[model samples]
Target: MTSAAPHQSILDKPFVLDLFAGPGGLDVAGHSLDIPSLGIEWDRSACLTRYAAGLDTLHADVSAVRRDAFESLPPEINVLAGGPPCQTYSVAGKGAGRKALEEVKAYIERLMAGDSDETIDRDLKKLSDPRTAMVLEPLRYAIQATRSHNRQKRPYDVIVLEQVPAVEALWHHYAKVLETTGLPDGTKYEVVVDVLDTETYGVPQTRSRAVLIARRQGLGQPFLPEPTHLAYEAKDWNRRAERATSGVHQPTLDAEASAPEAAGPPKTDGVVLKPWKSMGEVLAAPVGTHPGRRTPFLVRSNYGSSGIPGRRGVRTDQQPAATVTGRISRFVVFEHLDERVVREGARFSMNEAGMLQSFPPDYPWSGTAQAQQVGNAVPPVFGAHLLSAALGLPTPDPEDLRKPWQPATVEHRAKLRSHGCGAGDACTARCPRPEDQAPARSSAVPRKKASVR
Candidate 1:
């Protein structure tokens, strides 16, 4: 596996264009690896936050790109990536997408069958939730890139996407369509789809996403990133967390566990693969803080199967976090075994919440509904691993994520700020994000199943 292109020099880095990019999670990861990337997001708050973090961004609806609103896109961009909205398809929420699953698959078949955009749009208008149709949006770009008629005679070298696990079946359909598609030059794509656990890739959350990567054929076989951190059984995590909540010291992993990976054994490019990271790792008091002053606490989630204002779920600081959703404000913390403390900063700060998603501690989060952006982001740590694996490049050392966002080969984000929005009058136009005009407090997340594993 290598980053060298088939026809280009070994030193040329591929450029990336990400669609529906929420707060630049993948962009952060791309920048960390020194790969140039630009994210197109419609949400004003998310775009503002991305700008504050010095990430390159286009604050516009992805649909606009379809209408040729962006004509100056660089021809050098050979990688297309995005994670479209998944609320309609999410099992944890309304079943509009789930109920229309077969309809969605039929749409993919129709799309690949050369159905016109007008035809697809006309039929899509019949769906209960308009967002359900957005699931097929990524394919529009992918298919166009492969066409010889487009100005760019060459196809994108790689295409990547991710969404909630409920979208796994849809991604499989994508893989099938992509592999079978061929351009006049006999160029086709090879695709792979997998349900990836964020924790397995060293993310502090247990979120799972259905990811698809389609590499233009003849660019070597594509593969998913090997898991670095071992998976922890939910029961074990709960038991260990119980002990920690009761004042017992809970180590990262079981010291006496028989499993080699559980023991933090070395593997994967000879780097020592470690146990899954815990909330304590990111949530622990800063280095200069007095250790004795930081007391033990557990996060209590107010939203769950028991319903809001009913039975809540709790996770200890010693364990990885339960999935952090867009409604992150629902999770609160209390004194260990006491619910009434209401301590200062007990509710996670924006930085703490972002860190839980493997974002840099100082990743400048700006604008309204910042929590929604953090919750919606793909953890940058895991994003780097996925991109590295798909691009046939070296997977980075996960241990190095602890320090401030500095990586040995990474350039400062300030150098890329030129791609951000223009100032003054030029930025006057509000991004066309009609769907994002909702009250920040009313943000919704797909209902997730209790993560026992």
Candidate 2:
């Protein structure tokens, strides 16, 4: 269904409706490309952040919007975009989806077979984790949107969905069903699905995600954009971040270990890939102009605590970060005055975590759970490339990814601080953030703490 067909201008009247729009990640990407987007989120925390960023937001339920599509959504919405909840399918979370992969597939089939909303809702509750069923939400909307397209009424030009790589099989199911949608001259959702490397797209983290891009057949082939940066080579597990403070204590979670391998090597036709961005460079200064942060340091993850000899995760400034998560703040940075003398370890501030996820350094991070919101967000830089590919827009310039972003001055000093920590708590490597939901540390082996001020 893909081709090297001429591109058309979707900018003339583009309106995107992003479901599960956590912290406006994809919306940030959309706005960066001058595309108009409205993100619908049920989480009040996320919606608060969206309002802070000034991203058009609809604080409503996706399923309810599905029921009231015509009344809630405008007729000009051409793009349907979202990443459904993947808690059950995420390798890091419960294995419900994996345990019942066949059952999940069967559910997809049932949804395609025209099951009523009440029936599907009841069936979805049977799963241990209801999030597993949310994956089908996009499909439900697509099926309805395609019906509109068939009637040439408020037709959608494209639909894109993303989720954990473990959900790749589910997306393939989405592809087959959408391909047959609007058949015989209506909007055929010709799709391409695959896993994308975040670092390969200029993000300074090695996170991976499964993506599905579907364009109306009339718009020609919809290809995932070529990687703009070389993929990082994993270093030996024994490698340390240039400090003599402590020996190997825990094993990093190795989030990318479960990332579904791309079906084939990335297509390199007509594009040159640059070296992937480094943690030091991105944290140091805006690629082009800003010069506030001059001191580069090493980042030690709070992820891997699987106490094994020579098993640790240490990221040097020269390397890309492992994965940015809510607990990223717990990961301390060993400030290097020279190379041998290390200063007391300190964790990233709210803005620092945002930058690692490719959000503007000044992006307003409002409300609580700021770290989780930033961590869970789709890297805006990567999203820009994806939207460009899906919407027939010109590929974004590599420099644009590097350009200094306009700072968010939405009452910089007014937003609330950490979710649960007191303003005077003096959070450090040992701060047991009560608000975070990670499992408790293993009590058998005593852990070392970073020297704090």
Candidate 3:
């Protein structure tokens, strides 16, 4: 975790409301920055999860929530944030039924108006022009309702919505809604379809999401945070940095070399760093071992699992583990030992999996099964970076939270050899029938600690 700098002041921090706040990742980001927030989620488990994180949670469905509820909240809310259910729009679920699409439209409308159950149901049944027609219903209702109330305050000073890239189509309708609601043109709202990886901000996983930030007329366009750590590169193999005690080197390149190549070198004249975190780093220990009793799985099939591992599995000391999913899979890939007790498998723990997605270690999740809850959450770290940018705050640097790895000491190597492999060349040799002796250990290692300032 990065040390908290003395920021401008508490009063300057914005208040936030997180809609469709599954497991509270968005709320977690708000709270971490001392931004008071209210989270609304319909799922009982999700509500409990947010509550566990010390957030004010409303268990009512966003579609059913009345406009008065929003009006009841403090008028100081500067940011309205949420990652509405994406399952209906995700490419994986490609066939986004009209019903599902309408639901999304309704939710947006409600967000705009405050919901009026009587009018919503009647209009939704007859609504056409699926795109605008669906969303405009709630928006129109809300506008009229707010106008009728003659409330002195606007619903929210800023609105942030996150979803898959496909959400751009909905923006046109949302923009129209803004116009109808008296928001002036050139209102300084931005819809970013391409997003940088969250891992670039220090969370171990690489997750790309689309973010939209809309502010009331006066605020400027939200600033996107700059990349902090460069992607790991082969050229950086020899680079070293100074540290408080001994020097530390960056982790050797793993499977991340296959990361989608960038168009060109970054403008920042330093070695490019990888944007995705390795499963090895994220999965520090075996599954079901952490205090939360979460378990990690190997994705063998799309949506099934072989159950969690027990014993007798390959070690993952060198190879990158399987892609972590938000759902269970056919295979079980936890840290386990083979018949020879060789711990050589590519797997991760649930905690590490969440970290890869940039969620804080303590973010709460509640569900009947561990996989269901963890898989359904957004990484809070990613949300924080996104929200920080939306609020025009400087983005947090990924290196600021990265835990530098210490090279294996001589004793550690000896321990590895004792486990089974040969002595001299066994420990350092790369896979694929090792030929040459491992490279000599460097006395002058690069320093790993650098601040963002």
Candidate 4:
């Protein structure tokens, strides 16, 4: 697939705009590939963390921003990636899918009609649902950008969006909207949407997200990412963890017995993929502090004395972790010490949660907000694979994993101070840098580029 337009070489690299950017998860993935990335976040704490990481950020609510605001961007935006706030669509949340879809459509129509703020605010307040319609904001930007710029000079080349699985239907609706509605030149978009599991991308967590990739007509066909890691199975785990985690009846192994029969693997992308990374292998330390042979924890949300139906708790060290949610504080961890297991209370720290999400260990995290951000973030490792697919770059080297955890660098802190921001002002309004022009893609990436099948 090749570009349909002619002209500048500046658009060679993707210029990423991560809306609803949380703690720079997607941006970090983009940065690792040497792609110039900018984030738009409304949360003060998230913006603080982004700035501390030396990332370019704009602390503004995405719903309030106008499409014209992006006109100042340097390189033509090749990729517009975002994971809108997903509370309303998440299973852990209200699961208000039908209502959310309707509201979003209505909101978009109102916006297109140039509805007054007072009228919009009245309607929004009456619904009392701030997050449901938030998903439409990105589509609004996409529609406007494509309309303003002709096909030969499109504003954006690719659109990448992610959300909880429950939003898949909405995404399908969105794809229809983009496909049926042609641009000013009667050009339609090529769209693909599917749900992807994080573990399949080698992340240590079993988080699944709905992904959408849309290419403006003539930018080649839209492609979906394929799994780079092995699917999780009971037999493909460390012995101790396997015995502790697997729910299927596992045959006891004699010390001298031959290995169990291995299942034939499925082929994808014409490559033999590596096994999924387990929580035990990633942590290296025992998980689940409660007394038992288990070393990993099966955490759930809002499971208290209420006796929820889907509240079966299990333990293991062999498999990937359950989806990391905002209520990570409620996850209990047990420790195995000596010959006995002890109640370690909440076993995971913010850093641990971030690590499970494939964030660098030394990634600077701040306070309670850090936990929420980490839990909601798209794992950077998974992000790397998707962004690489978008850029037609080869998959990232498995050896190039998350960086070791460490405190913020003096240079990072100094840059924060230069903007008059400090540790104390992590939740305050601070200065914002002007429009960022990303540098050329670094040569660190592998030279072998491949397209998705």
Candidate 5:
């Protein structure tokens, strides 16, 4: 579906309504671009963090809200942006079973079919099952918004949605529904769907998400954001230079090309995207005796535990970090003095983790729930790229792609002093016992005292 292309200026200042706005990442990105936005989130801790950051927020369950309640919004709320909770749909989640997945699909089909509320409610049988049916909330709102325009009359210009790659098909279905359903004015949305790599957009973490961009009637075809960074797998500097100067537009080269085998042989000439930002660049301490130089370290999550060695735990300073999660504080790293490694380990402080997510340093974290907030947040840098793409605005300069690197200030350090400890306890590490000591002496290593002090 397509429409008359709207000018970039109409997109420049669209009022954005961010659903599932976890910690206001999308809003931060929107505000940075001077696009007015408000975040709606249910997590109190995340809401607190949003408040701390001064983001406009609605602290309510999105599923419970009604469209009429939002009628007071600015007449030009052109962009409806959000990433619904993906726990139920995420492959990493154990609850992602065939039945639940099918139910979500059925939910979308029914909603788009204009089933009565009672009929839809009856079909939602596993209401008690936490993971059941949350994925359809965006469709619910989209339908409600459409209904409102049909009645009270308010129309949105753009809709942007994202989720884990697992939910790509679901989004495709939603897009089809939106594209086919003309508004009372006999207009339809132009929908585009793609899975985007967060790393390709300069977020330090290599997270991938399914994205749906839809522009309301009279706007051009929705488009995915171009990557701003080179894939981490693009190791040939000479090739990078060649591509940088070629000015070629290569869509598949962004994420798919990151995998040499899957993407086939590398193209000597490709997109001009810059190299993926390394976790080290964001988390490593400068090494030297000088004023701005500090030692760096490695963090290992669940270091001493015995298990299947799950997907990833230990993160070295030089690589981009594994995805940040609520438990990101569990990933431990070594502290260094000068060039020597300190065996004692400490995980990323909330400030560092937030920085990795492209949140501002000293973002005024609240409560002890730092990791939870950081982990759930959409990386603001990636969010900014999404916003730019949705708004038809130019992407920010590469230099502006990430939070500026700066050493922690004394006050910042003080604020994060208690952040690295794991849930309900101080920091800990596993150290080898003396070789000759009895089994009794070989107990778990005493928890390491936090090194921040």
Candidate 6:
């Protein structure tokens, strides 16, 4: 938990190359921690967003970028960080895991050779699917391609891989590859896998991601950040329960509650289980009075379950929001309306959704459709925490960061408490029904009945 000095400046700091950088969330966090960074992204709008954030961005596919290009740069890059595309490994997508590997393999081959001509194109095209292989394959190649440099006494100090929990299995291969290289097995690299929620890091949302931290030789073991904010159930105060019982509050239950009684919580805490950020905190005013000023279809869908039109219907003063997702279908959907009020005819806007993900208010996203950009972003606050930890900087003060973006009301705890439940008592409201609780009747009258017969 190293803290940065007040006079410290990120300008001219150690360099980082952000691969597959989306909307520059990682870059933003890195810069906040005083780490200088550049990004490589294929999406035009994402490039614009990065540029607006004052980041040096390359508008090209990461796989197409060669190691020489990086080698040629004046500054020495200390780290390589990015979350490669996860569609192949995502459960929502067809499980084309192996195909995804080939795609990365082809990209790595081209990058290593510094060639992206017909041969590379042909190889890339040969892969019919990209969902079967581990999403980190390209990263593996990037590291190996750069390994020769390590032998020359210069190597990347760290590589951070962010992805869905499903990608954890891929780290073994990455570890093995790092070992094979001449870098000392334990000294050269280490892998850290853990669940991180944006809320804990002071983001308004409760998005949890599986973060993998791998450090090159000579650097200290990459830090796994401590939880800054606990989930509703795990919070020190019973704030979650208070809000839930209050008429003014409506908390989004985790996705597990949707399952049948017998089915247990998902083995992996799916993103749905995380708390949610409110819509009002995130949405911006419509661009103009005209219909064109209204929000897009997908952005409106984020609030569908609340039965409130236009507004995300989030109650402020609650825990941060759940993890933001790309598809509206994953969570309950909301209706679109024109006004900001949670009225019948109001609509939801894309800007609001982006705020929930903790992107800066001024982030420049130049896409016609807002959902695509919003879906691709990682919450900037979450990224900032990780970046700070990695650089051995101090954690941001909780008060200085955004408070949990949940709906809140000023009600006494006693007013919200259940009638039969006490401070230490188990919840009786969820207990078995009265009839089920009755003891079974005994059958000791058999002899008397026989005599009577």
Worst 10 residues of 5 by lDDT: 444-453
lDDT by residue for model 5 over 1-453, one digit each (tens)? 212244264454578888878777787787667778877766655655665566666655566554335554445666788887655554444554545676776777667667876777676764655445567776666666756643355456788887777778778877777788544344478889987778778888767778888878677666777766655542342244236447432111233233223254333234455557766666544322112213545455543322323422443454466566666777766654221344675556677777777776556676546777787777788888777777688775534534433334544333332231111122212111234211111101111111100
The candidate that wins on lDDT is: 1
Off by over 4 Å in 2: 1-11, 68-70, 91-95, 146-152, 180-187, 236-267, 286-291, 305-311, 337-343, 398-453
Q: Give TM-scores for every candidate, taking all chains together and pairing residue i with residue i.
A: 0.82, 0.77, 0.60, 0.74, 0.72, 0.60
Better of 4 and 5 by TM-score: 4
Model 3: per-residue lDDT, tens digit, 129-237? 3232323332332243344333453445566666544444564456555645443212224333344444455555333455556655556444444455444332222
* Whole-model alpha-carbon lDDT for candidate 2: 0.65
Best by TM-score: 1
Greater-lDDT candidate between 4 and 6: 4
Reference-based lDDT, each prediction: 0.68, 0.65, 0.45, 0.60, 0.60, 0.47
Task: Report the lDDT tens digits of candidate 2 across residue range 1-453.
Answer: 333445566547777889888888899888778888877776656666776676766555577667664344666777989987766664444655577556677876776677777887888788775556667777777666655643355457788888767778888877886687443224467899998887888888877788999887677678887677777655332333211224533222233431223444444554556667877768776443344455656666765533533434565566677678777767877776332355655678777777888887667687777877877788898888888888887766645545445533444312321221122212333222344423221101111221111
**Ranking of all predicted structures according to TM-score, beginning with the best and ending with the worst:** 1, 2, 4, 5, 6, 3
lDDT, residue 286, model 3 = 34
Task: Give the Cα error of residue 438 in candidate 4, in Å.
Answer: 32
lDDT of 3: 0.45
What's the ranking of the predictions by lDDT, best on top? 1, 2, 4, 5, 6, 3
lDDT (10s digit) by residue, model 6, range 1-453: 222233222223557777767777787666555567777665655554554455666655454454334444434676667776665554334546644544564454343444534564555455554323225334543444454453343556667777655555555445544544433222346556665555655566545566776666456556565555434322222234335546333332322331222254322223223233334333423322212222321132233223444444232222333445554223332334222445443333454455666665435555443456676676677777766666555664433223222211223212212211222222343322334321211100111110100
lDDT tens per residue, model 1, 149-187: 443566778888988777889998888877775533445
